[model samples]
Target: MTEPTSANADREVLQMIPKPATAPEIGPWLWAMEETRRGLLRTVRGLEQDALDWRGASGEDNSIGSLLYHIALVELSWLYEDMLLVEPPADIVALLPHPSRAPQGGLQHVESETLAQHLERLEKARADFMRHLTPMTEADWHTFREPPDTDYAVTPAWAVFHLVEHEAGHLFQIREILRRWRAQERAAP
Candidate 1:
């Protein structure tokens, strides 16, 4: 656990605000992450399969589904493996299912689950993440968490931001897909 360096001094001003004893002062960081999760849920809820599944018609990287799964999987993995690295929390692994084991051909062969099921699991995982992060001591912010068997460089803090970005980008793509889909739907003979 690392202490706040001079680099973060400007950002730590709000850390002075009182937080509930239970939640601690993980404040702006946690709030930002929660809002991001909420935004993702809004995009994902009640989405049609075509809207969710459509790869870019013109051929582009990152289908919406792929992005959503990637975001959710990485966070889930962080909460499970990364958090346990130094002290090794056995109880935590028993808390939730490990993320779909990072797929077969690395990032390409990710798992397939219904949109509803994925959202449900992700929502649960989000709650679990809050439980882990909300009480995180200031020291927890300094250290980096790198998962074993993976080359990714993500701290728990960065993991939250990464999830937000992935979800938001896919949400944008999803909307674009929906726009074109609606046009096609109405244009049909």
Candidate 2:
């Protein structure tokens, strides 16, 4: 049998073991987030610029580009606004140029950005989130942070859980969009 290269060997493993995280308490949550991100990245790999921006003819729905931007922005928002209880520092602010919401209460439309730019933004948000939580104690992980304007409070643990769920949902959406994009292309005269 032929030997597989290191890169191919890495792809051969299809298991769900939780890798070690920054802290023992957060190991599983971080694992979930990391796995979800891997799936998302795989889904969007090699997407052309137009596929990133495509809105599927109706032109009002969220595109893959907007979803990618929103996912990154939500992680940063939770890290700063919810957990740290402050505005995103200047460095984080520079990573996301658009406001979180559009005028019509949807994700802001992100266009013209290459997939590489979107991935970079996501990496920044994920890195910042992991770094900020590395030193978190068990008390902080379970303690709730109540924002003044929000209807409900959230703990670090629950917030990280929600991020995993959120990203998974968006990943499903991205896959469906990709499926439709290909179907449309096939149907074109």
Candidate 3:
């Protein structure tokens, strides 16, 4: 092979540069998110309505539906708000309504939504996320500044890891809810 001339080397270097880099990437973080998505589907598939409706007799947090909504909220919000950090911003809240604050009443507090609705919404959010990520410019990821969280200081890269981990954490919660509900069913006469 012949050695490259200076002109050729300069051109190659120029080609390597991209528009921007908006995030840091760790491959395991992405794998973890995909795995969580699978687990969430497994937990809910073929289950009856009551199973979806069930909130643990002891838990105080939101139901599976609320958790799903939270995941969607973060995904789309990051896409428009932080990742792009646009002005006259994309109003994701209007597109995806957030749950209103309400008084708690045992399981009734979390029993606020059906399983199918939650899953369908999450599915769409996942699709949108994949679309946005696929063609992300290298410049977009590298140029990305860290977004501020009141209690947390996070770089664009960390945000991806955090979001992925957050979904996984919630998926595990769903797993527990399913486990608890199944136990209740088995105990029933």
Ranking by TM-score: 2, 3, 1
Output the TM-score of candidate 1: 0.62
For residues 90-188, what per-residue lDDT tens digits would candidate 1 score against the true structure? 543443343443454433322345687667656666676777777776667546877778876566666656666766666677567667767866787
Off by over 4 Å in 3: 1-32, 59-61, 87-95, 100-112, 146-153
Per-residue lDDT tens digits for candidate 2, residues 1-189, read: 345457664577455565465457887788889999999999999999989999977987789999999999999888888888888889999998899899989889999999999999999899899888867877888899987698989998999999999999999999999999999889999
Best by lDDT: 2
Task: List the candidates' TM-scores in order.
Answer: 0.62, 0.89, 0.66
In model 1, how large is the Cα lDDT of residue 126? 68
- CA RMSD (A), model 3: 11.0
Number of clashing pairs per prediction, in order: 0, 0, 14
Q: For each candidate, C-alpha RMSD in Å?
A: 9.3, 4.4, 11.0
Local error of candidate 1 at residue 33 (angstroms): 1.8
Q: Give the TM-score of candidate 3.
A: 0.66
lDDT of 1 at 6: 69
The Cα local distance difference test for each model comes to 0.60, 0.89, 0.61
- Which scores higher on lDDT, 1 or 2? 2
Give the number of the best model, judged by TM-score. 2
